[model samples]
Target: MPDGLILPIANQKDYIRAALEAGKHVLSEKPVAKNLEEAHELITCDTETDWRKNPVHQGGFLLDGGVHYVAGLRRLLESQPSSKVCRLSSFTTLLQSHLPPVDTINAILKLESGVSGTYQQSVGTSLTGSEWTVGYEHGVVSVAGSKVVVTVAGNTEVNIIEDERTGVPPVVRIWAEAIAAGITVKDLEPEEALADLEVLELMLRSGESDGLSMSCQYQHIVSNPN
Candidate 1:
C-alpha cells in the first residue's frame, strides 16, 4: 500500500512493529501496549526508571483507560519529561458488580506546568459520549457532543461542529494533514509516545499497586477498550 496509512486496530505491539518495519507511520490506540514490559518491547529502546517522587495517590480506571485521558492532557500541553512532573493522587471505589477490578477513581493531577486538575472516572456510571475539557491559565475549552465551548477572560463562546463524528477527532485529521504535507508529526512519534507510556505506567503503578502490590496481584490481561 504505497502512500497509505497503517491504522492498527488491535494487537497493538505486533501491528505497530510491522508497520514501522514496513516504513509506515502508525496511529495506535491508547495505552500503547498491554503493560510496561510489552510496551518496552514495542519501542525497541531502553527507557530509564526515573521517578520524580514516591507514590502520593495510586489507583486505576479499571484497566487503565485512564491512559487515554492522561495522554491527551500530556499532548495538549506537549508535556516533556525530566523537567515536567505529573503528581497523581488517586482513590478507588467499587460501585458496580461486574466492573473491572478497579472501577471508579478520582485523581488529582498536578503538572509541573502549573496545570492542576482533577479527573473523575468510572465504569459504573451511565456511558455518555466522551467529553474532554482542557483548562489553561487563560481559560478553558470543553468539547461536549458536537459543540465546543470556550470560556476565556470575561466571555464565553460556543461553536457547534456540523456533521462531526465523535470517534474521529480533529487531532487525527491534523495528523493526516501533517503526513500529507510531508511534515513530521512530532508529538505522535514512537519515541514521544513511549514517553507518555512511561509516565502513564508509572502513574498506574503508583496509583493501582500503591507502589508495592505487584508481588502477587500483577496479572497481565488484555484490556477491553469499551
Candidate 2:
C-alpha cells in the first residue's frame, strides 16, 4: 500500500486520521472541508515539539504556491531572510463567472499590515484576463504563466526571463536540499496550514454574514495538535 491516498473524502477527520494511521503526509487540493474546525480535526500531529515556532511560513502563488502569504509577511516584517515586503493595495475581481463559493472567498482578507488581496479565480475560460503585480520597495515583479517581468528603480526597461519547469524545479530543489541536510521538512506544517484555513473560513463567513468584516481568531490546531 502507498501508506496514504489523496482521493476525495466526505469527512475531514476520517481523511486525516487515515493518513496519520498510515504514517504518511498528505497534500490535499483546495476546498478542504465543510469548515475550519473540520479542517483542523483532519490534520493530526505531535504537539510536544511546537513546530509552529519554526522560522519559515512559505506562501504566495508565485513564491510558494500560495501556501503561507501571511507567514511570509510576518517574516518580512521581522526582517527575516526573504524578499522585501510589498503592500497589496487594491485587488479587483474582473471575472465572476464562477460558483458562489468562489465569490465568497473573494472577500474577508484584511491584513493588519495594510496588505489587501483578492481571490479572482474563475472556472470559466477566458481569452483575456487581468495580470498580477507585486510591488516591492525595490521594484515590481510580475508573472503571467511562464513569462516573468521585473522592473527595478534604476532600470529603464522591464527585464523578461523564462525557463521550462521554472517554478516546479525550484520547489523540488528546496525539498531535496532540506532532506539531504538530514532535516525533516513538512510542507507548511499542520498548524500553519490550519491558520491559513482559518482565514479562508473567515472569508466564507464574511460572505455568509452579509459582508461583515471578520477577524480570524481560531488557534485550535496549534492548541490541540493531534
Candidate 3:
C-alpha cells in the first residue's frame, strides 16, 4: 500500500475515505468538497476534473479557483489569534459568457476579532491586475504578481519573488515532510481545508441569496503562542 494518497478534485469523498480507512495519509486538491454537507462527510471521511466547467458542478470555475483565494485570505487574517472570519456577505456574477455559472465575487468579511475586510475575485474581467493586500495596525502588505510590497510608517519595502510554481512546491514539500515524520501539519489538515471550503461555500450561498449575510461554521481559530 502507498504511504500517502494525492487525489484530484473529482469524487474526493470516496477516495479520501478509502485512503484513510487504509491507514494512508492523503492530500487532496482544493475546495475539499462540492458543498458543506459533502465536506462534513469527508471530515468524518475526505479538484478539478472537466466537470469544473460544467454548471452542474456548482460555481463552475469560481468554485474551482476561488478556494485558493479563500485559503490565502484565511491565512492572512489568521496571523493573529482572533482573526478568523465569522461572517460574510457577498455578491457573485458571471462577467464573461465563457465562464459559466459565475466568475466574479465581491464580499465583505467580518473576523472574530472584530476586524473587517473585502475580498474580490474575478476570472472574466477586462481588468489587468492581481493583488492580495492585508492591512495591519502598523502597516500594509500587498502582493501583486511577482512582487510583495510592504508599507509601514510611510516607508515602503518591496520584494520580488518570481516563482511561477509558488504555493505548490512549498505545500507539497510540507505534506511530504509531515508524512515522513508521521505527524499532521496544521495547515494541511483536512479540517483546515474544510474551513477554507466553508468560507467559499458560504460566500456562494450568500451570493445566491443576493448578498444576504452568511455565518461561517468551520472557521478554526489558532491560539497565539504569546
Candidate 4:
C-alpha cells in the first residue's frame, strides 16, 4: 500500500484494510463498504478513531455532501405528506453499451401517507442530469444542480445557487489542509456516511431480489474506536 492512498476502485473496504495494515492511510470511495458490517470491521481496526485515516467520498459529489441525497430522500418527500419511506421497489439495468456495465437503477418509493415518487439514475440516457423533484397535491418543487424551481397557485418561482463544487482545488490539497487543521470533516462523519452505505446496500438487495421491495430507516453508527 502507498503511504497515502486515494482509492476510487471497488472492493473499497478490502483496500482500506490492506492500506492500514501496511502503515498507510487511505481515502476510499463512498458507500465505503458493500454493507454496514464491513464498514464496522474497518472502523474497529483503525483503533485511533481518526476519521481522516479512512475517509470515504463519492466521485463527483465529493464536496456536495451527497449522502443526504440517498438516505434522506424521504425528507424531500415530506413536502408531499408522509416523511417516512415504508418500502421501495428497485431494479438496476445495463444501459451503457460502450461503457460496458449496468449504470442505471430506478426505484419507486412508497410513502406512508404521501404521494409515491420515483428515484431513477441513468448513465448514458437523456436523463443523465442530476435533478430532484417533489410533488404534492397543490404544488411542485424541483432542484437541478444550482437552480431551484417551484410552481403553485398559478405562480412560478426560480432561484439560482452558486455551484461550490465547480471551482474547488484538487482533493489532495484539501485533504492536506484539513489534516493540518486537525478536525473531522462534518459532512463525512460516521452518522452521515454509514447511513449512506446502509441505504445503498438495501437498494442493491432490493434489486437482487428482482424488484421485491426493501425497507429502510434512518440510522447512525455509534462508535468509540480505540
Candidate 5:
C-alpha cells in the first residue's frame, strides 16, 4: 500500500476519505475542495481527476490557482492566532472571453487583528507581473518575482532570491520526511489548507453577491508562536 496520496481537485473528498480509510496519509493539491461545505466534510471524513475551464470546479482557475495566492498572503502577513481573515468583499469579472465564469477579482479583506488589505488577481489581463505587499507598523515589505523589498524609516533594502523554485520542493521534502518519521507537519495539515480555500471561496462568494461582505468560518488559529 502506498504511504501517501497527492490528489487532484475534482471530487477530492471521496478520494481522500477512501485513502484515509486505507491507512494512507494524503498530501492533496490546493483548493482542497469546491466550496466551504465540501471542505468541512473533509475535516469530519476526507483534484482533476482541468479545473481551469470546468464550472464544476467552482472558481475555475480562481479556486484552482487563487488558493496559492491566498496562502502566500497569509504567510506574508504573519497571521497570528485569531488574526486570520474574518471578512471580505470582492468584485469578480471576466476580461477574456475564453476564461469562463470569471477571471479577475478585486477584494478587500479584514483580518481579526483589525488590519485590512486588498487582493487582486486576473488571468485574463494583458499585464504580466505579480507582487505581494504587506504593511507593518514601522515598515513595509513587498515581493515581486524573486525580489523582496523592505522599506522603513525612510530607508529601503532589497534582496533577490537566486532560486527560481517555488514552494513545492520544500513542501514535498517535508511531507516525505514526516511519513518516514511517523509524524505530521503542521504546515501541511488539512485545516491549514482548508483555511486557504476558505479565504478564496469567501472572495468568490462575495463577488457573486455583488461584493457583499462575507464572513469566514474556518480560519485556523496558528498553534505555534511566530
Candidate 6:
C-alpha cells in the first residue's frame, strides 16, 4: 500500500509479506514489488491458496499486462508433456507515449524444446504491436496483436483467430481452472517469478556496470518453508 492511497504499505515488501502471513489469496499489481526479495517471498512461500500480484492491471494495461506473458509460458510448459524452459530473453522500449508506457521491455524465453518470445509495453501507440510467439519441438505458437496462431510440423494447422475483448481469455482462464480444481496455480510460480525478477535485477545491475557481469545476492531472508 502506498502512503497516501490507504494501501497497506507503499513498500511492496511489507504488503506481500503481510498478505502471506494472513493466509489471504491476493491479486496484486504488476511489477509485483519493488525488488526481487519481496517478489521472491511472495511467490516462494508454501501458501495454501492462489495469489496474484501483477502491475499490469494496476498500471492500467488491462489483461495485456505481464500476466499474459507469464500465463502463456505456463500454458506451454504444462501442455507439453516433455517440455522445459531452456533460456528466455526480453526486449523493452524507453520511447512509449502514445499508449501505456511498458517500462518493462521484451523477453525471449527458451524452453528445453524451443523458445518463447514476448513483447510488452505500457505507453505506445495502439498501432505499435505487442505480441508473443512460442517455438516448440512439434511446432510453433504465435500470438500477434489480438490473434493467436499455432502450427505443428506435420499436424494440421489449427488457427485460433479471434478478437481480443473483455475480461480474462484462455490465458487467465487456465489459472482460474487450476484454482477451481484446488490446484496450486501460478504462472511462473512464486519462486520462479522471483528467479525472473532476480534475472532482471542482474540485467539492470550489469547494465549499470557498463554491461560488465555482476552477481546478485538476496538480503531479505525468509523463514524456512519447511
Best by lDDT: 5
Expressed as tens digits, the lDDT of each residue in 1-226 for candidate 3 is: 3354554566677876676565555667888888778877876652222211221357878788888878877876777778999999999998898898889999999998888889898888877666798888899999887789999999999999877556777888888886677565688876787889888888888999999999987786342111
Task: Between candidates 2 and 6, name the one with more favorable TM-score.
Answer: 2
TM-score of 2: 0.56
Task: Judging by lDDT, tell me the better candidate of 1 and 6.
Answer: 1
Per-residue lDDT, model 2, residue 219, is: 34
lDDT (Cα, tens digit) per residue for candidate 5, span 76-115: 7654765678899999998888887889999999988787
Per-residue lDDT over 1-226 for candidate 1, one digit per residue giving the tens place of the 0 to 100 score: 3354444323566666766665555566656676667766765522211110111112334444666655555655553442243466666656776664556666666665556666666777887455778876799989776778999996999999786554447657877786677664555555555555555555455556553321211212122111
Q: What is the TM-score of each predicted model, taking all chains together?
A: 0.62, 0.56, 0.84, 0.65, 0.86, 0.52
- Span of ten consecutive residues with least summed lDDT in model 6: 54-63
Error of 6 at 189 (Å): 4.6
lDDT of 6 by residue, 1-226 (tens): 3121124323655665666666654545445554565565665553533343321122234222444455444544556543444444444444545444334444444444544444343444445555666665688777765566778876645455564564335535665565567565444245544543454544333333444533434312232221
Stretches off by above 4 angstroms in model 5 are 1-8, 46-55, 162-164, 222-226
TM-score of decoy 3: 0.84
Model 1: clashing residue pairs? 58-207, 59-207, 59-208
Model 1 stretches astray by more than 4 angstroms: 2-11, 22-25, 45-65, 79-85, 127-140, 167-182, 210-226
Using TM-score, give the best candidate's number. Answer: 5
What is the TM-score (0 to 1) of candidate 5? 0.86
| Candidate 3 residue runs with Cα over 4 Å from true position | 1-10, 46-56, 162-164, 221-226
User: What C-alpha lDDT does candidate 4 achieve relative to the native structure?
Assistant: 0.59
Return the lDDT, model 1, position 71. Answer: 57
Per-residue lDDT for 99-199 in model 2, tens only?
Answer: 22232124424444565555433333344443556677898766564455778886735545556544445545655565457454444345555655555
